[model samples]
Target: MNEFTLTADFGMTASDNGFIQYGIHPGDTIMFKKAEDFPVNGSIVAVIIDDGPITLKRISFYGDSLDCYLEGGSSRVAPIFISHAEYGRLKVLGVAVSVIHSLAPAEE
Candidate 1:
């Protein structure tokens, strides 16, 4: 797939155990595409949960059910399993094709 980039326009800060953590600083570029538009194994994606907010995770399948496995980056633990009924409630926002972190210099 061709590579592309997106700039992050917002930032979020959360705390755990009285320690503050930051994620996705504004102006950071991220490369991504629609997950449903390109369903591939081992792809990281943003998915809608219960018609609620969007979340990011790796995609997997459990029998006829769709599953999402959370990688240990933050304090969040455990894998999430959703039945076809529950899966229907989820909307695949986008697949993370690549990441252009703030630490990295911009490419020409």
Candidate 2:
């Protein structure tokens, strides 16, 4: 059998309630690292929101927008709006490039 590895380039170093305010799925595993340490684009990340937390699909339009699609059986929510100030507050916890499901095959 082949071994699978899911690599995250950026993440948070410490546990911040602000970061976890967003709902985490029952089996979801989050990898924490620094947000700015990475290239800053084309990465899937968790964004902190006023109402809750969200996982961004990617950094769109030169960091002006955030794209996030639903995972697993979750339904799709509207795209998150990030203001310039808000964008600055976003700490890249890591770029989630791939996911390894417990019951399913690894996705990259």
Candidate 3:
């Protein structure tokens, strides 16, 4: 599996709701299977936009578009829909398997 360190929150935002207790904080390292190495359904994935920085997201495929969710999986933020026409702009690198949590607390 390939790994990458997070430099931003991505979709791992904090929540006051008690049901959502965990999140991938910045500085956490994520291990993921390469896109071609694994099948991606409704799984947490690493995504790159226009060759930009890699970030974490939960992705699902619809008929002609893709649905991308944030940390809490639609509970916190609305999904970003990527239509078939925009497929070239973004790419899914892989499916995230695990996260190495950072020991230090996050800076506010």
Best by lDDT: 3
Question: What is the clash count for each candidate, in the order shown?
Answer: 0, 12, 0
Worst 10 residues of 2 by lDDT: 12-21
lDDT of 2: 0.44
Candidate 2 lDDT for residue 31: 63
Q: For candidate 2, lDDT tens digit of each residue in 42-90? A: 4456555454555444444343444322222223434444555555545
True-structure Cα RMSD, model 2: 8.7
lDDT of 3 at 67: 44
lDDT of 1 by residue, 1-108 (tens): 998555443322211211112233333444566544635656656667678865555666655434544332345556666655565766777766444445653343
User: In candidate 1, what residue range of length 10 has the lowest lDDT sum?
Assistant: 11-20
Candidate 1: stretches off by over 4 Å: 1-28, 63-75, 104-108
| TM-score of every candidate | 0.55, 0.43, 0.55
In Å, residue 69's CA in model 3 sits off its true spot by 6.7
Number of the top candidate by TM-score?
3
Q: Give the per-residue lDDT digits (tens) of candidate 3, residues 1-108.
A: 998665433233222232223355555566676676434566777777678876566666775434433343435665676665677777777766666676876465
Candidate 1: count of backbone clashes, pairs at least 3 residues apart or interchain: 0
